[model samples]
Target: MVVHSKFQSDTVLSYSGSIPYTCYEIGHTWEPGCVKTFFQTFCDAFKFSIRVYTVFYLATFVIKLRKKENRRIKKIKKLLRDILQSSIFLSANGAFFMGGFCMLRNLIGKFYGWHGLLAGFITGILSIQLERKSRRGMLALYLMNLAAETLFNMAVARNLIKPIPYGEVIIFSIASAGFMSLFRQRNGLPENLHSPLTLIVGPEESRDFYRNGGNFSQRWRLISCLPYLQKLLQRLKTVHRSHQSCPHNNSCTYYTLEGIFKQFLLGYGIQILLNALQSLRGKQKWSKVFNNISLASFLAGFIGLFRACNCSLRWLLDRDIPALHGALSGAVAGTTLYFYRSTSIALYFFFKLMEVLYFRGIREGYVPHLPSADQYLYASTLAIILHASCCEPHNIRPGYWKFLCGVSGWKFPVMFRKLFDVFGTKATTLYPNFVPDLDPRYVKTTAVMELLKVHGKWRDPTNF
Candidate 1:
């Protein structure tokens, strides 16, 4: 009797037989079973948390090392510390909220769609309340969450991406937004901040500094040129004032509007240049360039109008409720752009009203007690463990991933430099003839020589 194997290496075997025998390849890998999957998920979650903690810790450490004697440095340090604290709290709160949302969704089987929306709304409110102590921050978080959910649903409807489980997505978005808002809250600086130029040079000297072609740094190059720009503005203002007799109070408004318009025009010009360059790179036709220019001009004009309106509102109210003003201006912009649908518009309005009510509540001594730092940490650990056990891995992309990637890319060069320093020294000493190219004096001296020259020149008072 002859027997045939039903399986072959790297191929399926076919045979007609009453009895079947299967043979397996020696080197093929099998799919992960339940145990392996659980271990892998746990490891991934732990690594992610560690990465988050390490990145923030290192960043804060770097900022702390800067000279803190200067007031600006002190303020920057405080801002960094506050940011680190807020981020840790927000991440912890978000994880807890997500775990609860997933649990609720799993428990409730019928009307999955309604269950998801309700869960998302509740999670959003709770997440915002826990993540931020300020009423303004909370309101902003709520409105942004609504807007994001609306956009995501629209994208799904249009088949831009696969349908997401809204509950899971909402939880992920809240966490992602919390991190983003923490960074963006103060324009990547401390809150209620003055310009660094104003801080560095007193008001009297700042004019001269600007007049001298401000060379503070690459970031503040624009500020250095501001004095020259302002002089031209003043000249134009004088021309307008001489042409028309205007009261001082009315003149201030006119000047403010004029500044807004000037800024808009300047930005429009820059946009056109950038669009032209992009068009050249992409080999776009003239029609596309015209469309780009037109769109850019429209956006620039809208931004200018929004700023003018915001300034007017602040001037009239004589109070600084930037959150309220921002929402109102954003609504106008949204309406002008035809960006939001009826549902989203209504939701926005509802959030605006809620923001007012919430502000009032806080004013009336209704501030909610927030969780302590220790509690936040404990909750985060528990939430992470629960999520690892019960939920599939979340694949939501963060808005700042590109920024983080750019930051992390620097590590490779730094590591390579350090390795070369250590190995080059040892290799040159031990095997000079065999590894002559590894000598640190030859390979790494160029940068050091350049720095030495700069230092020597700067040390001579004549250079300064």
Candidate 2:
């Protein structure tokens, strides 16, 4: 059976001491108000970083990095691209955050004994499909995820191992969607205009295909879309017998860059407004805002059902999977949230160290193989710091854990132990069983020493 003792709490409340330190009178002297100060400082620093990165991204274009040859056109193009890209990024991020929020909400309900969790799960699945730009791919991903989820849930229900917590499920779903994004990167389209589109079939064609279900029916239905099919050719000949040039066919290769720009502008204008409003409540500083916008845009430009799936998967399972010692694990988890940011700022400095060391190599002029090498490293490093801070032992308390489970919105028991085990291998390495040869005092402060000391010791019964 599963059990939770100290974690149980009524009405979620914030507490800050030595973080998770339980110093009941006869314990070590602890910092009184450091936790609250740390959180506030972190947020303020993060906001500043976001502002700097945003300014640089906009500045780089304005300085004409892309179009140095022509001053006038450079300004126009730079402004145009920035506006268009920013708009797309904001909208996609809004969708991403919202989708993730809903996915987590559903998972929480399902894991806990809430009646509405299953209902929410069904709605989330359908809503995600409807929200996707590609119905076919979305349907495919939905079915695939549903299968995985059903099997995983069955295993949990039967007590084959441990019950996966709602937190882990939320993380897994988001990670899966992120992984799908990586695979969905388009190799065919140009960098600028590769937005995804939905595929639709006519009504009459749908009916005819249902009536005759053989190979012939399939071939004929597909041929209907082609203008050069034998049936269409005969019909065309009957309609126009004249072998003369038509007025509509007169030669003209007029190109309107302005029209293309307008099309881009109009579509993005509506989109940006929606996104900005969605994210208005969580406004950070300029650099952090910029980082959020750029990262969001990069993900947006590669929009598709597959990418969404990638993001979801990464959120769900990335934490569990072992990679490049502890380096890859931290980088993957952190970078998923941060890339394309600036240093000097606190969050940037913190997260970037991870990116530069673990993920990116500065050989020759570029960090090869990795996607968006520079941005990824910069952004990921920042994210690692933020995540570390958020999940740190000191920042955590019984109330936050309850709130994280959505127990108030829907009181439900989640198997966090099993959930942690899903990513146990990676987490184990991070909170290693044995201390290294070096002195503990000399190790990097960012090693999450406090968290490691607790979970690490817990992993070994003999050590206790």
Tell me the TM-score of each prediction against the true structure: 0.35, 0.21
Model 2: per-residue lDDT, tens digit, 284-392?
3333332234434322322222222222333455422212112232223333323222211222223323332333244434655554343333223222221211222
Task: Mark the 10 consecutive residues where model 1 has the least summed lDDT.
Answer: 20-29
Q: Best-fitting candidate, measured by TM-score? A: 1
Candidate 1: clashing residue pairs, number:
1
- The clash count of every prediction, one per candidate, is 1, 53
Q: Once model 2 is optimally superposed onto the true structure by TM-score, how far is the C-alpha of residue 187 displaced, in angstroms?
A: 33
lDDT scores of the candidates, listed in order: 0.35, 0.30
Alpha-carbon shift of residue 347 in model 1 (angstroms): 9.0
The digit string of per-residue lDDT tens for model 1 on 386-440 reads 2211111111123322222222221111111111112111212211222111212
Please report the candidate that would top lDDT against the real structure. 1
- Global lDDT for candidate 2? 0.30
Candidate 1 clashing pairs, residues 3+ apart or interchain: 214-224
